[model samples]
Target: MVRGRDVILEALENLNEDEFKRFKHRLGTQPLRKGFSSIPRGTLHSLDRLDLTDKIVCYYLEDYGMELTAEVLRAIGMLEEAVRLQQAAGQV
Candidate 1:
């Protein structure tokens, strides 16, 4: 079976540099719901896109990683990537 990290990596890989930067910005800055924290700027600072995706998956686990990733994608106007992620994960 395809891992959630694989799905997330694919989505991130599809983004151009600017979009990927925006996505990381959102992850570092967005206000998450209660009990959930945004990724720290320091944490985000050191990682490239692939590492960031891995961090998200490991930190949030598969399910929440999928949701949070899609949410961030949509927040940055990447609806197609969000949908594709959900579909790939069989959540659509």
Candidate 2:
């Protein structure tokens, strides 16, 4: 079985620099409430793709991490990537 972390990493790797930046921006700026918590700007600022993937998995675990990744992807207009992630994560 494909691990959720690997799925997320692949999705992030598919992004170009600009799309990755938008993904990071959306993740960092999300309002904290209930089940959603935003990563600090400083924390996200220096992360490369692998580091960001690790952080998401560490912060939210596999299932929620994948979901959050998809959410951020969708927010950045990476709808195809989001759907791919959702399918990979078994959310579709």
Candidate 3:
């Protein structure tokens, strides 16, 4: 079953860099979706959660199917190695 997080995850996955930047700019102004509220709202170092969110989104821009997991790994700065392992494992 598709959940609200799934929808937001898909949307983030599809957005391009420019589109994501615009989206971030408009995020506070946009009407809140019930789905988005559940995402954690803090920062790591000086980076906003939205920045990590966008990276996760961008990571799936190609044919990558592991968007959610990849992005979470990316958020913590481990996406590259993880993708490499995924590729080595023939999972990507």
TM-score (all chains, Cα) for each model: 0.89, 0.90, 0.35
Error of 3 at 1 (Å): 0.8
Query: Top lDDT: which candidate number?
Result: 2
Please, what's the RMSD in Å of model 3?
12.0
lDDT of 3 by residue, 1-92 (tens): 44323434444445565544444444323333243332232322233344544543453332332334334334444545436434533422
> Once superposed on the true structure, which residue ranges of model 1 sit more than 4 Å away at CA?
none
Please give the lDDT score at residue 34 for candidate 2: 71
Off by over 4 Å in 2: 32-36
What residue runs in model 3 are displaced by over 4 Å at the alpha carbon?
31-92
Q: Could you tell me which 10 consecutive residues in candidate 1 have the lowest summed lDDT?
A: 30-39
Candidate 3: worst-modelled 10 consecutive residues by lDDT: 37-46
In candidate 3, which residue pairs get closer than 3 Å at backbone N, Cα or C atoms, i.e. clash?
A: none
Between the candidate structures 2 and 3, which one is better when assessed by TM-score? 2
Error in Å for residue 21 of model 2: 0.7
